[model samples]
Each structure stands twice: as structure tokens, then as C-alpha cells.
Target: MFKSSHLPLEHADKKSWASGGASSSSPMEYPTPLNFYEKPPMFDVKLEQFEQSALDRLRILAEIESCSARGRPWDETKRIVSTLCQKHLRLSSNTAGGDLGIMDTQKEDERRKDHLSHFVLRLAFCRTEDLRQRFITAESTLFRCRFEEATPAERTLLYESRDFKWVKVDDVEKKSLEANLRATLTGFKNIAEQNDAWDRDAFYKVQWSQVPQLVEHRRVFLKKGWAYVPARQQSAIVFREFEVHLRQALNMTNRAMPQMDEDTRLTPIIDHLSQGFLAGVASDWQYEEGDDTTKLRAEQVDEYAKKHWPLCMRSIHDQLKKDHHVKHYGRLYYTLFLKGMKLDINEAIAFWKKSFQGGKVTEDKFNKEYRYNIRHTYGQEGKRANYQAKTCVALLTGDAEYGCPYRFLAPESLQTRLQISYADQGLQSSDIHEILNNKKGSHFNIACTRVFEITHAKYVKKGEGLGQSETVTHPNLYAERSIEFETKKEGPTKVTSKQEDDDLEGIIMQVD
Candidate 1:
């Protein structure tokens, strides 16, 4: 709906942004900050640049979703999103100054990357209903933020540049609708005050469908299927229209994606990007000092499993408790997880020692059979691999029982587990439904992250927990984060066992 510098690749000339020497009269000036991605940008791009830009944009969209999922305040979400965009996906306007070294050519390249990346991710995310809706929410929020921050003159230019068919209400028409317009004005106590506001502001009439959110909120005057939208709330029309066009484009793109399979290079990138998004767009994670894991205790394993562990680890812990023994992979997964949580080797031996008692694996057999494997995990025996906790990516393809529950559990099973686990934390049927939907959509990491956020919503609403959730990357991350939020009242207790870190040089040495 907006005039973009973007030109569909099939129709564009061979010259790319970086390559050029032709002096064309119509320079590729994007002209405005906001875009609706009406055309795919034409450019000679290498596969590396294609993948990188797509990822950078995907990060921006993921952050927007995370902010909303964590219930961040709108103003704060805007601030955080702005900072990230400036860092990873900056789109400077034509007039943006040299203080930032934004040359005309550089500006064109930025616009090109922006356009290309949008289309690439559009292809990647268009494959499913869940993906399409997720894409819509993130993209709409991004468009709304950019529209809100644009200068008044730029905003007007944006509207003029687009063919949205918005009709300006005349003074004569305003008088006829003045009473009804005034009715929609909030924070005004008197008719005179409402009249002043109604006269001072402008209004645009658009199809009611284009601004459904405003109509639904009863913030606009609706008559005969048209919405009389006040200037201040006009961004709703922009966002809704963009969303509408994007949804249609995505479905079209989804149909066209099969043709992309012929482009062997691109197919993999698109598939990988889409798969990564479903797994929650992995972010780098590193353990740091002062994490609560240093205080982990053997006796707290059951309670912590209930409160802090990811579904995968929790399932293994439960299996070990009930049966007093786990299969080889589950034992390996859980032992390394406990190690990564900084559980002392002595406590590790003791925890399994106690867990395996009163069952087939007696204490003597646990010491002879299981303790060796636990020590091997810590580099005290065997090849000294000294394994770190498994990542969600690795675990998803690893052993069945210890892998992601979101990836493996039946809908009924997952729902029942979620219901029982979070019943005390105000888990609603809708939350359960959302988790099930994401699971069905194969957004396992996102589903896991949602479970974390929803289950902890009680404390977060009270300003007492980690305000945001990362897609579950590792069991230790889930474990540590849960310990932070769930046990706030108990506080970080005294270290029940050794808190000192093992030597990295010693641990990371070649397997012996």
C-alpha cells in the first residue's frame, strides 16, 4: 500500500546497491521510514548476506513478541525495540545526518536490506497458521512503532504516498458528526471541552474493517460500516491495513514456496530460518558467576523439579523417582543437567544415591553401577567428556524420554501435565490451549518459554520475577530461571555444597 524503493527482483535491472555506476534520475530513496513491503527489493546479493539480514530482522520480530509475552509496558517495549532495531536492523531516513555516517548509498542499501529481509522472512514464516499469526503480530507491532515515531510531515508524506483511500472529513461533515465524535472522546467531562477537542483534531473515514481494533475498543465513531477515526488514533488503520495486506501476501507466498525448492541454495536457508523461529530463534547463552545454581542442594531436587525444571528434565526426574532408575540417556541427560546447575559432585552422588534406594538399583549397586557414570559426566572417570547440559536443539533429537516434552508429548498428555503443574499458579484453560496450539505448530521452544512465563505470571504481575522469558535453550537455563523467580521468598539459601567452579582448563581438556 506504500510506495517503496523496493522493486520486484524479476523486473529489476542487474545493478545492485553495492555495485553501481548508472546515474538514474529516480534515485532509490525510500522517502519514508515505514513500509508495507509491497515489492521484493531487487539486488545482487550473496547467500551469506541474504541469510544474515533475514536473521537480524527475525531477531527484531522475536524481541517484539518476547516483550508482549512478558507483559512489558508499551513505552518500555518501544524503547527496547528501538534500541535493538538501531543495533541490528537500522533503517535511516534520507535526511538522516552524517553524524551517523549514513551516506545516500548506505541509506539505499539499508532500505534494500530491509525490503529483502522482510520478503525472505515472509517466505520463511508463511508455512503455517501459527507462524502466519506470529508473523502478523510482530510485524504489526513493528509498523505501529515506526509510524508512531515518524515526524508529522513524514507521517503525512507516508499517507500521501500510499493508496489507502482514506477520506478526510470536512468541517461541514464534522459538525454533523460533532456530537457523536464527542461521544468517543475520553477524559472530557463537559460538552464544551469535547467540542473543543473534536474541532481541534482531524478525522479520517475508512472502512470499519481496516481499523477493527479501534472499533472494537469503541474509541472511534462507527456508522454505516465506516470508521470515523480521530487523528491521534489513526495509526490503528495503518497497522491493521499492513497486517491485512501481509496476511494475504503470506498465503500467496506459501503457495509459491514450492517453486523455491528449485533454488537449492535458498530452500535450505528458508527452511532453516523457519525451523529456527519455531525453536525460538536461538540466542547465545553463557553461565555466569552469582547464578543461584551455586546454592543447589540434593534434597531440593524434587521440589526444584516441580518448580524450576523444563518439562524434559522434570519428566526424567519424576521417572527416576517413581521407578528409581532411568534409561541410559535420561540418566546421562539428568546428571549433566545437575552438574551444569552447579550441584556438587558429592551431592550428585548422594542425590542419585538416595533416588535409587528402595528399588531395583540398591545403594550398593548405585555406587557400583550409576556413580561411575555420574563421575564420568564430571570428568572424574571414563573418557572424561565432562559434558555440559544439552541444548534444546540437541535434546530434541536425542533420547525420547529426556528430550523436549513440547516436541514429544501428545496434546492430551501435554495438557494434563500443564494443568497439574500450573494449577496452583492460576493456569487458565486459554493458556493451556495456547501451549497446545504452539506445540501442534511445532514451536516447541516458544511453547516451553510460554509455559515458563505463564506459570510464573503470578509473581511477575507483582513485580517480583524475571520480567521476560527466553525460548528455552537449555535445561540449566530453565532450572536457573525458575529458581530465581519461584524461590524469591526463600531467597538464595546458603550453599549446601561446594560453590567453587571447576577449572575450565582441566574440564575442557581433550577427553582422556
Candidate 2:
């Protein structure tokens, strides 16, 4: 079993239990700890603190998830995660040149936040198998990064505290098996080549099954049923164990998921976090003056669609035009994009009502069912929440007709659409094939950007100023960049400030 030092256990015997009878006439007093370092706070935290902490942690985890999904090298992921932790969570690196003694107060608080945030995400992710697997993979990578970043002394302490037991290979046995060890163990080969160096270090013997990664990498020497892992490469062995134990724990958590639903406060928070994770962080797409896109008049949408809109949005617009209506998810998606384009509630109603009237939807039926939803989207009704544009991540993960075309569309379907859409623009079939190939290899955003580059090849070759060379992760970003490219032919075009561009590409996330 993998036990986290910071996980909280509920004790029925505690006097402060909600269902327990009071022993004194006065209200039973509960012990209030100064911080989570000493004990888990059973009471509610301040709303601001709760939200800030969750958002900060979410940013870190989201980066880890994105990096893992892209198959980034572990060293790069570790550096990015460590830097983000320092910037957002205020948790500094423990591996700055030398081993430092633990600072109890600071370290404990950091540990508490790490523990609680993980459990919170677990609740969010355990509802679905796909979500659970993603969460586990990202979390395992994060844990490995932290382990690698920790000082050797800190790692030793952590290992000892975890009580993992492995038999050590004796010096005499090591010498007797020198030839086999040299032949089978890659790490040992270097040390074996130098006399007396092999005897200087201790070797741990574990079951061959326990270190499948090393076996797969051919990094350990195997004899009979045991694998002899060098102390230096032991972290790999330990991380595999961590992954296995975590996978089992997550499966168990999923089975007990029903109990988690009772906590209404946390349930909603978890839901939002899951959505944010899928949609990209909410903060990334905040509009600033130079980078902000102009709101298009309803009449101008088709014009803008031709010159600026991304393939996904363009596809949705075309479908709406063809059928004079869209399915529920498609309608919601299209409406939000229009809303981001600054379509007023009145204009939006007129536009939708006109489109639907030509279809099976009567004007009276549209007013009855759809008008209020449009008003709601514009924040004129109900909770008055301002709906933001849908991001590529959210659309890709969503189980809806409206999603990223590069991801959701079948290859044949996508090819057909690309050919039809770009026929007049002179995009070659070879270019289309390359774009689809990139999408197949999981370069989804890159594929979208490639479409833009191909269509705007003249402007690109002429060096018309595009703000930055980033993959288009949002429809709005694509539109804005395309607009800038088109406008530069007539006169000077406004570009996003370096800081704003960096912010968009950095840790600030887009919330849908």
C-alpha cells in the first residue's frame, strides 16, 4: 500500500464528530490548529484562500499534464514544474546545490497543500476511467520530478519513512557474479571497467517484476527471479512501484466515488477544476488592449470567417449556414464564439431566430425555448455568468458534435473538409496530407497553425508582423492573428505587447 504522510483519517471517537453527543453543558470545544502542518482542518477554510490555493495548485498540475501529454522530456518537465511551483505555490526547490535541513513550518505547509490539493483532484478525476488515468499519469510524473529534485539526504529520509524493504547484495556475492553483472547491467559496465569501483557502492536486490522498467531498459542484472539494481538507478525502480500503488489506489477511489458526491462544496469545486483542466486554465485568455479582438457585427461574421476564423469555428459556421440550424452542443459552441466576437444579445437573438425560422423551428418556438438561453449566455438572466469562448482542450475532450475538427473528425472526413475549404486558396493535397499527419501524431494545435500558414503563405513569406510563433490553442487567438496578418497589407497593424504575448503563452490559463 502507498501511504501519503499528509492524508487525513477520520476518527469516529473524536469528540467533535458531527453526530457525537455533547458531554458538557457548554458547547464541545474543538481544537483549532494554526495550520494544516499539524493537523487537517476539519472546518471550512476562508473562501479566498481556498480558491487561490486551488488555482495555484491547478496551474502546476495542468502544466505537468500538458507536458506529459506532449511526451516532453522528464528533465524539461522537472525544470518547468519546479519553476512554476516556486512562482505560483511559493514552494522553492529543495535541490539547490546542497542538502538543506528541513524547515518544519514552511516545509509542512507546502506538504499539506500538496497533499490536500492531490486529494481534491482525485475526487474530480475518479469519476471517469479516462480522467483517472490522465490524473494518475500526470501525478506520477510530478512525483518523479519532485523525487529527482529532492536532495539525496531528503530522498533517503523519504524512503526510510515509507518503509520500503529491499535486500542488499553483499560485496562477496557481487564479486562472485562480476561477469554476469558486467554483461547484463549497463550501469555496472562502466564501474566494472574500472577496478575496485564496483565494490565502493551498495547494490539492492529486488524481484524482477518490481522493476519492470529497468528490465525493459536492460539497466539491471537479472539472476534467477531477482534483479540487482544499482543504488544510483534505484529511483527508477521506486517510481515504478509508486505508479503501481497509485493506480490501485485510484481504482479503489473510483469504486467508492459515490461517498465523495455528498460533499456538495467540494463536488462543485472538483467539477470546475476538471472542466478547467480540459478547457485550459481560465486566466490565460483574458483580453488586453493590443491583443484584444474586435467584436464583429452579425453581418460581418461570414467575411471574418473567410479571412480569420480557425478551421473548427469555420466548420461550425458553415454547417450552421447549410442546415439553417445546428445541434444543441454545436449551437452552444457557435453562440459562445459569437459572444466572444462581441455579438450583442439583441443581435444574437435576431441572428439565431432568422436561421432557425427557415428550418423546422418556428419563430414562436424559438422565442419560447432558445431566446432565454441566448440571454443567459449574455449574462442577462439566471446566475448572470459571463460565458467565455471554448478552448481547444475543452472542445477536444467534450463528447459533442462540436469539437476540434482535427481531433474529432475522422481522417477521411477531415481530408474532405480541408480540400473543399482550401480549394480556392491553392493549398496543395500534399500540404493537406502533412497537416493530417501532424494531427495523427498528436500535434493538434500545430496542424491548425499549419492550415493558417498555408493559406497565408504570401504574407508569411513577406514577413508581415505576426506577434509570436506559438501554436494556436484557441479560436480567438487564431482569428486575431489572421486579422493582424490581413490588415498589415493596407497599413501598419497593431501587435500584442511582448509581455501580453508571454502571459498568453505562459501559466495563465483560459477558463471556458
Candidate 3:
């Protein structure tokens, strides 16, 4: 539970958050590395902090889903998830680091963020059945990830903090179950080869149904209806318990959500976070010209679109090449994405002018019809709104010609492009089938992320973990990540990181 250090429970109001004047009087305690998120924090959060915390947590969970989708080994998954947690959800133990006073403050702050973010995401994800299931799986996996890294003392602290109610297998019962335990020790070759440190091995008895994963994997010694889970495999029980509690909590949150619908200030952020998760890369961070890695030229559009563009932009590029014209929305879509790719206004005008000229448009006509809108998109005209590239979420509801190909293109057309057209840079036949399966399930962005990885395989080194940046939420993000991964050899991985900026006025997040 979060300490009421920042706000008094009686006077806790959303007004204080809007004014940003809350102060901490006392410190909070996290006590344990793992959390069940069983209690909702009563503290207030500023709008920005609320949004940022949910986004940070969402990134970690999104990466967790990606790891399983990609079939990463547990060690690799843990390593990748651990690194991501350090960045977004670091829950460092009390004994390992320096300066207890300062470090404890930071750790408690991190835990506070963790607690609130979990509940915030609950509110965001509880709106739909799919969302609830996803939240349960991701949150449970996150708990398991942390539990695995917890020290023995930290584990003890966790048991003290929460009543998991798992019964310990006493030494008498342990000896009685020795034959069954050895029988289920499938991970080992023979009983004689097993270690002699019998006193060190610990076991807990739980209902067999509580940990079907351990039972199915033969990792636990089962008798009658009880599964005796070893200390080393306790995560299975913990994960199952976390998942069960979360599923029930989501239902409760959903039933209590009517009041939330009236809070217009919060619902949009919640919806935004939900949409980002569905898109497989939840972020509100806007990109800027300063974030661009390459000085893209007009001549490079064709080559780059062929080599580096995601399916959405690549499909649009293909349309422009074939017809020398795209409809209004299609042109707008391509222009904004190109702008995000850091194609200078002059080069953008040049690229469009040349492509359109090949069909019906003369220079004068191109200047009159297309050039101003391109300039308008670049913030040189109209309201100077500086429209952003349509994210994967936005693309789903936008024009089919300009939208994500996975969502818009016919199954036959998508298969042709993936298997026949982009196969050189994209997926193998089996990879195409797997991605198409995701597409069938309406996980369009996940399918796009899969395509991006396959096509850009040369840029990705081993252990190139998936993070928000690597997931294809926006067409520009796809291009940016492609460029970043290709060029970066040894620097810290910006491979899955997004650029943060205040220029979100142009953010095109209005999706259904």
C-alpha cells in the first residue's frame, strides 16, 4: 500500500493535482519487490504524471507480450524484461545499492509509481474483455519477472506483506513425498545424480488446480489433488495467484467504472493508453525534426520506401508509383509520414512533384493542387497545425489506401505483397503465415512489428529486445527504428526507445 505522505486521505482531491503543489511529509515503503496490485492507491496524480506512468508501465507489459509472441527463452525474456524494468519499472532491492537514505527515497518513489500505474492501467484496460485478459497476462508475467529476481530476504518480506496462504510442506511430509518428487524431477536424469543438499530444498503444497503450468510441465510433485511446488518453481504459483486476482479485480473495476465515464479529463488518456496497447506500442511521445537520424533526400524516397518503409507507407508508395497519383487522404497520409521521416520540406515537395508529374499533373498543376497541402502538412500554411504521421491506431480508422495494409488490404492482396512482393526484404513463407494469423485475429500492429523485424533482420543483433520503439505504432516510428537499428553498432540501445517532446499538438491519436 502507498503511504499518504503526499496527500491526506481526508482532503485528497483532484484539485491539488491540477495545481501541482502537493508535498511529501513522510516516506513510503514498498517492502517487497513483487506486488499483486490488490489495492488501489488513494493518492492523487497530476495529469502529466498520470499519463506518463501508465505509458511507462504499458511499455513494459507490451514488451512482455512481444517476448512471448516471439518465443524468447525465459532467460532471454527475463534479461530483456529486466533491462526494460530498470528503465521504466525498476524495483531495486534495499541492500544492493549505495546511499540508503537517498536510494530508499528513490526506491519508494519507484514503488509508488509501480503501485499507482498498475491501478491506473486497470482502469484503462478494464473496459473490454480482451483488454482485461491482456492486462491479467501481462501484469502476472511482470510479477513473475520481478519475483524471479527477488533475493531470499525480499521473498520473505513479500510473504510477510501479503497472505498468499500457500501451505508449506513440512520435513515429515517432504520425506513422505520423496518418491513422487523424484519421479517428477524430469529435469534431472536419475535420482542418484540429484544434489545432496536436501535441507536447502524447500516445498509448498497447493491445490493442483492452482498451478496447472507446473503440473503440466511435470515440475511439481503431485499427489491426489495437491501439487508440491519447490522453492525454485514458486513463481508458477505466484504468477497464477497474481493472474487470478487481477482477473477478478478487473471485473470489479469494470462494474465500478460508470463514474469514470463522466471524468472527461481522464478518459481520453485512458483510451489513448488502451489504444496504444492494442496497437502493440502504446506511446504519446511525439517525434521532432531534431530526432531524425538521416538527412533524407527526394531521390531516396523510392529506395527507402522499398527497403525501409513499413507495410502501410510502403503500400502507399507503391500506389503512387503505379498510378502517379493518390487520393487526397492518401497524399496527406504519405506527406505527414515523410515529414516525420525528416524529409525536408523542399525535398518533400520535390518527391511529390516528381511522382505526380509522371501521370497527369504538370508542374503548375502540381504546385496548385498538391504543393500547398504538403506545405500545410509541414506547418507552413493553414492553421500551421503541423499534422503528424498517422499512428497504427489512427490508420485503422482512416482511409484504406493510406491506412495500415494489414487492416485495410484484402487478405489476398496482403498475402501477395507479403509473400510475393516484399518477400525479398520481408518474411519467409512460414513467417508470412504466422503474421497473417495475427492479422486474422485483428492484431494488425503486432503483425506489422513482426514484418518490420523480419525485413530488418540485418539491423537486429541477437538479444535485440522488443520495446515500444521497436513496435510499429506509427509509420514514422517504423522508419525511425529501422534507421536507428541499422546505424547504431555499440551505443546504448535506442532500438526500442522513443524520443520525448512537448510538441504533441500534432499528435494524431484520435482513433476509435
Candidate 4:
């Protein structure tokens, strides 16, 4: 009954044809477009149900975040989610439940439902109760400290000396403070552009500087007041307590509330808004490859599905491979999602066509250049452009699991990373020169994100010999390029939020 605007043929209509044993040889017919030649963007989530589904999926993601971050392993969480998918989300099983082996009689008409009733109970066993108790104690202390910091000051000083009644001289911090302001501005901008998914209004409003203010101008009431030390810290404290309550609520409804952030201006909003989306994407109808051959009995199918469940979700399994690339994971996960969405190759082509609007490609041009490319990528009789399309979609979706799509580097950070890499590796200037100047030699930032792709090389044995290994590639081998400087000893020690520290404390408590 649920029909996407991009593909409005009813499920019943689809099922009718499917029941009659439709195959690629005997495909069901549908309407031809009036102007496929005009080349409009092929796909849009035109259906309200689709948007609602996206939102519903986001809600479930919040639940997953709250649950998994508390102590649950991704494997366990994924398994439960996979089970839910099989029961309700009606994707047919072709081979066995865990893999797509030689296509064995595909089952049509089965849809999986998300009945997440036991999500909370599972989370309860995810960690020991003792660990929960210690987390409560530590987080309680943090909550108290944060709250105390937010308390109103005992004395309030009015900035109204008769001579300076219009404004307070006390607020005149030196221009040097501009550096801090700039850093804050830049940090917020980077986060918003890269991570935050919600609309701009949710985070902040930029204001232009206005000079020569007139008296009694209500809009320009920039007050000069010192923030009391105690009160200044309480905002984060208050929000953190709220986070704990969310954890305790356990039920999905409580999880759906937007996460609270500590910064009044930006960081909190950016993290939560994007995380809300990330979580949403995580919770959409669980997808798994399953084989349900009629040759196998119902019990046999169930056993098979359970036994090979991990393989069916190979997107998760490939993480263990030495040469596992994050982009590949991003591509794999996204491709499967598109496939699960029931988007046919032609429909997918249409979607990409729309995505590249305002480009040089008209319909005819796109068809000649990229149309077959997308088709072939999605396992259709098209070309390799489909594979390239997956990468583009991954970049658009902001799955940093594959690395940043946009080239986001603060020049200073890049410079520092380059210096560090060279110094740490003891590479002489001549060595650097050789890499830069040699036409055949390549320059590699040991910290570059592309290192993930080379991990597949791990499985290949080194040299012409039988089995001597060379180097093992892992996450650590790819250095973090972001420069982190040590703050002055007198400066505040870095403090992580209760949400982050809870897991550590819980682990310790469990051990105790």
C-alpha cells in the first residue's frame, strides 16, 4: 500500500505480477514517461510516507545511539535489528538468509516490520547493573558540579555609572580576544557545514556589527557583565542530567527527544541535530540478505538464517578484513540501502539525473555520458558509472566513515600534520624533494584518509615466497592529522560529557 512518488505502482500490483513468477525475461510493464528525453532529476522523496519513514527511522536511531553508547556491542544490536527486518520488512529471500549464494528460488511478498519491543530489555543486559550504579554515582557528581556552576551569583553589579549609563567600560576586552572569537566562529562553521543536519535556525543567527548606536535603541542592548564562575558552568551540567534521564527512560519515546548540548551558541546543536539524523538513518527498516529456498523446511530456513546471519550482513563483517576500506563500507552500506528501497536500475538512473541538475548534461548528453554508468553500477546491464555513482552518493550522504567528502583542512592543521609526519618519520628534505620531484614517485601523507583503501593489501602475501607477511594495516596506522596542542598546566583540564564517560565508568564498575 505504501508507494513512493518516484515509483507509485502499488505493492499489490507489484505482488500480483511477482506472484505470476515475473523475471527479467518476462518483466511486468509500466507506463512510459512523456519526456524521458527531457531528463528531469530521476528521483525525489515525493511521498509524505517516505519522509515520515525517514523521520521514524531517525527516531529509532536515537534509541540505538542511547542504547549502544550505554554499553551494547554493535554486533548484538545489529542482530536484534536484523531479526526485526526479516519478520516485517517484505524483501524476498533469494538464496539463504545469510548470503546471496547461487540464486535459489526467491521468495516474494514477505515484508519485515520493526517491532522493537525488547530494545530496552536488551540494553539492560548490555552492561552489568553494578556498572550502571557506578555510572549513576560519577555522573551524579558531574551533574552537581555543572548545576552549581550555573547558579545565579550572590551579588549583581549594575553597569550604570552616570557617565557611561549607555554602555559599560567593564566589557571592553582587548582586541586580542578576537582570536578566541575567530576560533569559535571557525569551529562552529566547520561543524555546521560538515555534520549538522538540521536547519540553520536551530543553531545560531549571525549579526552584522553596528557602530554609532543611538541611546534607548532596544535592539543594540549589548550588556557588559562578568559571568560568575559558578553560574557559567551550570548550563552543561543541567543538560547532562537531562541526558542521564534519557538513558534511564529506556523506552523509544523518551529517546526521540532532541539531545541537549552544552554550548548555548553552536556545538551542542550541531552534534545533536546531525546525530539525530545519523541515528535516524541507522533505524530505518532493518535490511539483511536471506535465503529461503522452498527446498528447505521452515525450521531449516530459520536455522540457516541464524547461522549465517553475520555473512548476510557482510557490510558489517568486512570490517574485520585487514584491507577493509571505509569508502567501500560506505559504498556497500549505501548500495544495499538503495537496493532495499526497491529502486530499480532505471529508477536509480532517473534519480541521479535529477541530482546532477544544472550541470552540462542535458538528457541526451547525460544519457551518453552518465546514464548507462549508473545503470551498470547497480548490477543492471549498464556500465561502471554505477560504481562511481555509489561514491558520489556516499559523499552526498556525509558518511565520514569513508572520510570527508569536502576538502576540509585548516591550513595550519595541514601544515602541522605535514611537519609532524616528516619529523616523526625522519624523512630528510631530499627524501621529500625526491617524492615531490620524481615523476614516478608519489607523495603520501601518512595521515591521509585514503590509507583505508590499501588495507585490502593486507590479505595478499608479501614477496614471491610462500607466506611471509609484510605490514598489517589498521585504524591506528592511519594517523589522525588534526593537530592537538597541549594546553598550559594552569588551564582547565579537558572534561568529557557524562554521556562519553559513562561507558568507561560502567566498564570499571563491571570489573570491580
Q: What TM-score should be assigned to candidate 3?
A: 0.82
Task: State in Å the error of residue 466, model 4.
Answer: 55
Tens digits of per-residue lDDT for model 4, 147-255 = 3322132112111111111221122341324233223222244655523321221111112121112112222222233211112222332343334443464333223
Q: TM-score of every model?
A: 0.70, 0.69, 0.82, 0.18
**Against the unseen true structure, what C-alpha lDDT does each candidate score?**
0.72, 0.63, 0.72, 0.27
Q: Which stretches of candidate 3 lie over 4 Å from their true place?
A: 1-28, 97-100, 185-199, 282-295, 358-367, 426-428, 441-443, 457-469, 480-512
**Best-to-worst TM-score order:** 3, 1, 2, 4
Model 4 spans with C-alpha error above 4 angstroms? 1-339, 354-359, 381-512
Q: Give the per-residue lDDT digits (tens) of candidate 1, residues 180-215.
A: 887777877787887787769888899988887888
Clashing pairs in 3: none
Task: Return model 2's CA RMSD, one decimal.
Answer: 9.6
RMSD of each: 7.8, 9.6, 5.1, 27.5
- Show how many residue pairs clash in every candidate, following the order shown: 0, 7, 0, 33
Model 2 C-alpha lDDT per residue in residues 301-346, reported as the tens digit of each score: 8788777788888888888788887876677777777776666777
Global lDDT for candidate 4? 0.27
Tens digits of per-residue lDDT, candidate 3, 225-278, equal 888887767767777877888888889889877867666667777787887776
Better of 2 and 3 by TM-score: 3
lDDT of 2: 0.63
- Model 2 Cα displacement at 119 (Å)? 1.3
Output the better candidate (1/2) by lDDT. 1
